[model samples]
Target: MALPVAMLGPTVAQAQGWPTAANPDEVFLYPEESEDPVLLYPDDNSSSAPSSTPPLPNSPNIQPTSVRSLQLIGGEVLTEAIAQAFYRTQLGRPADPARLERIAFAIDQWYLDNGYSLSQVSGWMIDAEGVLTVEVVEPEVNQITIRYIDNEGRALDDEGNPIEGRTRERFLRRELQLQSGAVFNQNDVIQDIQSLMALEIFENATVAVDVDEESRETPVVDVVYNLQERLSRSFQASGGVSTELGLFAGVTYRDGNFNGRGESLRFGTQVGSRGLVFSTEFTSPYRDSRPERLGYTIRAFRRTGRSVTFSDEVRLANGDDARERHFGGGGSVMRPIGDWDAELGLNYSRVSIRDDSGDLAPTDELGNDLTLDDSGIDDLLTLEFAVTQDQRVNPSNPNDGSVLTLSTEQSIPVGNGNIVMNRLRADYAEYVPVNLFNTGRRQNPEVVAFNVQAGTVLGDLPPYEAFDLGGGNSVRGYGRGDVGSGRRFFLATAEYRFPVTGPLGAVLFTDFASDLGSGSEVPGDPAGVRDKPGTGLGYGAGLRIGSPLGLIRADFGVNDQGDNQFFFGFGQRF
Candidate 1:
């Protein structure tokens, strides 16, 4: 006799995916890592294991024995009629072990089909009445508790009792929403554990269940949550190169779990030959209180930089004439509505472009005014609303599932740079899992991904705020800001990805974008200073390496114009 579907524990490892630095001009935004799903339980009592032999009646070795009526025992589900139907043909002949195994499998599958994954057949026996009986053990949760873990790993007392953790029990309880008297549903428990990990306080969270022998009660089981907390405060230094920004470096300091309440505070700065940037942000989720209905985030930043453009001969030129400065601060409130995440926010930005030499305007040799209108200071008070749904198996490194995000911004005409504009954008991504060799492969699936992004702006829109479609995170094969910027754009991508080795994966991708014939609307382009073809096509391949810094990516792209480009950065392209 053995235990019913007992899952000893799940192994956790880091993977990648999720939102990253929106601007390719910036260096990096440290990303949140994801964990691999549980592998199949070892040669233990896991019903997920496939059947070892063929179905009954065809078994090569089976010695029949004379027996009375067959019977089924235990579990609240399944009836005599159902049991009889499973072995209706076998009743005409003598009972055999092969037939009994077949009946047990049917009962096991019925339990699983009903969402009772932890319940399964425990044993089989023969009674004095020559009757055969099969026992199905449906375990129920007797109690639940949690233990906090530190850097040295999980701690325990001499008796093996879990040591209390620093995180409050109430916080864990609110996410779990599991009752002691309820039946154990593995799917629900796994999802709750994921939410706990989402708190960002714990490095990993695993579940273990034990037989409650002392209770001597209806197959009672004890559930324990082992939580490993990550360092609350940490510092990271990053460096990267972009054709426009040249060689740039940055430093970041963060408190991921500030004040023991799941608040996050981060500050960062990047300086290079072409620009200097500084940013600070804080996020406070209702982790210790309720759900995300009360969460909010605040951010502020300053970006000042120069431009590289084409001169009179439509020749590449790095000029000091157009120097740009932008200062902005914004805040957003987030709430989880059913399966969708909703956000409302406001942002204020001041932008201005100056001419170091009034005599050095970016003009074509043809004497046309390459300089755009309103190069002076402008102010924008933008109100934004957005909603998103993430259904990926691993949001950071998805193998399957789909994600959709939609947002809009409305500017109010007020400040001296009073600007009036409305913008709408949508991004949709879908992933399909593939396993060319299905029998045995890595736990994570090889995947094919598709993504679409489209946006438009209506009103008095500035070039800086307009959609630019070239960068590591955008269209490849072109340097950041090298591609044209305009009021309307549509971009789509298709990628195939697979693991070449542990922690190292590869992807082949194709990306295409169109300016929707808005080349005329692209400021500073009418004079042929920068080529804006209205349509672009790029294809490339890249490598994804999992490291302490999340996923480090390198890509090489070739545009339709035969131009080649290489990109290096942190996080996934999406």
Candidate 2:
């Protein structure tokens, strides 16, 4: 009878239009009705291989303890004070049992964290002798064996070691932070893996630690590094178009790790509608067992349809289009001091130029015609000294760190009197990370980048040697060399980059630049220079796509004068 009454009440309520759409917010559940929450662990084990030994227990943060006569049984692995530091424990005082227990657990946890995952504290007890005994099962590393796996083409010998004749062990040895007979440190292992992968010769690197069966009492583990080598030679070709260069194609060949030594040889050529270029470079990171870098580069190029002038009036009249040819070669030697490099270099270039139409008499950008005392051909020899510090994590795309470079060059006349100048240039870039959402991660999701460059020529400056500030490489919203051309200039850029997906990113950037040269000048005056038209401003957004070749970059920019321009390149603008 009671059940029938309850059922009739629901029917009565429904008949009275009491039933309507349900509101999820009005629902509530008791804790007893809910299932237990599941705990999740991040997979440190490799996804490609079978799971590693079961994960270690997490160390709990414990309060400090004051104990008297603390004794660790396995004292050979660590000093007494060092073990106490790990637990933040003190001696010669009254100690709480609970706190002492935490200290004992923390000591074992420390060993596990340091790559002795199998180690433990077998016993933690206060004996009748009035001493606290902590038995530690610390394992030592007995050997380190480096294995080069998946290396074919006679690169390795039968014992799985790098062939002595074909391979230079020092090339691989220098990258390792771990050594034989050292305690196993997970941090060092991780860093060693990264360092090995950074080398161009290795496609992949891995490390595995295993216990030695024959040496169980001492409990020694062998650290093994497995490396996979990449092809010794590679070639790449690419075609691109920009508002400045119009259309261009380039091809490059590289033997970056020749003869298993960290030496690089590269040759590249580019042909475009406005210019043609050929260049070759060779670098040896270590010279004759010394920590010095030596490199040489040779280049030949020709360019046209680009104006290097300051006055718009003169540019409009003369069209400012000049055909120029240049051939140059340079050698540099650098000594590494800590993380910075101090370098000295010498360069010589033979430069010749003519008007697009004919060989006109020399004239300043302000239209003062004069005789330069000879043809426009000039052979110049330059001595340059530079200091550079690059701490960026990645060359193509950097999320943190800074790079600073300062260089000075003195150009001495060799062929004609047209080459006598002192040049100075300074450049700096910094990257700062941004995480507005407070994501609890070590790596940032976005970056704010800044760049600044200033250059000046103090002595007699020829038109070809003048600085041109514009185009995709400079102010961005203008065509090549469209901005002020002058003996002195300063440029600044700021960028904000955010990741969109894996290997895909976006950037918002702004550029500001100015030149220092007055357009009113005497043509024959050694200080003859034209005033920069005005300051240049460019703002844009760009897309960054990561590829095997490199980062593919594209930007759409707008100038202060409302001109729109587009740029395409292979890496970051700075």
| Cα-based TM-score, every candidate | 0.68, 0.66
After superposition, which runs of candidate 1 have C-alpha atoms over 4 Å from their true positions? 1-140, 147-170, 197-205, 227-233, 237-251, 260-262, 270-277, 286-292, 307-318, 355-375, 437-445, 523-528
C-alpha lDDT values of all predictions: 0.65, 0.60
List, residue by residue over 1-574, the lDDT tens digit for candidate 2: 0111122222322332322212232222221232211111132121322121221244223224335566677665556776555433335555444445434444443454455444555555554444556666555666666666563434467786764323477767666777776655566676776666545456446666665646366566677676766555779898897333458998988886766776777788778775566777777653323444354433343333334443333442356444455567878776765667677878877665545443543554455433333665667789898888977654346777899999999987677665677989999999887875443121223888999999888776665566777778788787665666666789999998877776677889999887655212223322233333546899999998865555688999899888979999977897
The lDDT leader among the candidates is 1
Each prediction's RMSD to truth: 13.1, 15.7
Query: Candidate 1, after superposition: displacement of residue 25 in Å?
Result: 64
User: In model 2, which residue pairs have backbone atoms overlapping below 3 Å?
Assistant: 517-531, 518-530, 518-531, 519-531
Tens-digit lDDT track for model 1 on 478-509?
Answer: 76655556678899999888777767888899
How does model 2 score by TM-score? Answer: 0.66
As a TM-score, model 1 comes out at 0.68
Task: Give lDDT: candidate 1, residue 308.
Answer: 32
RMSD value for candidate 2: 15.7
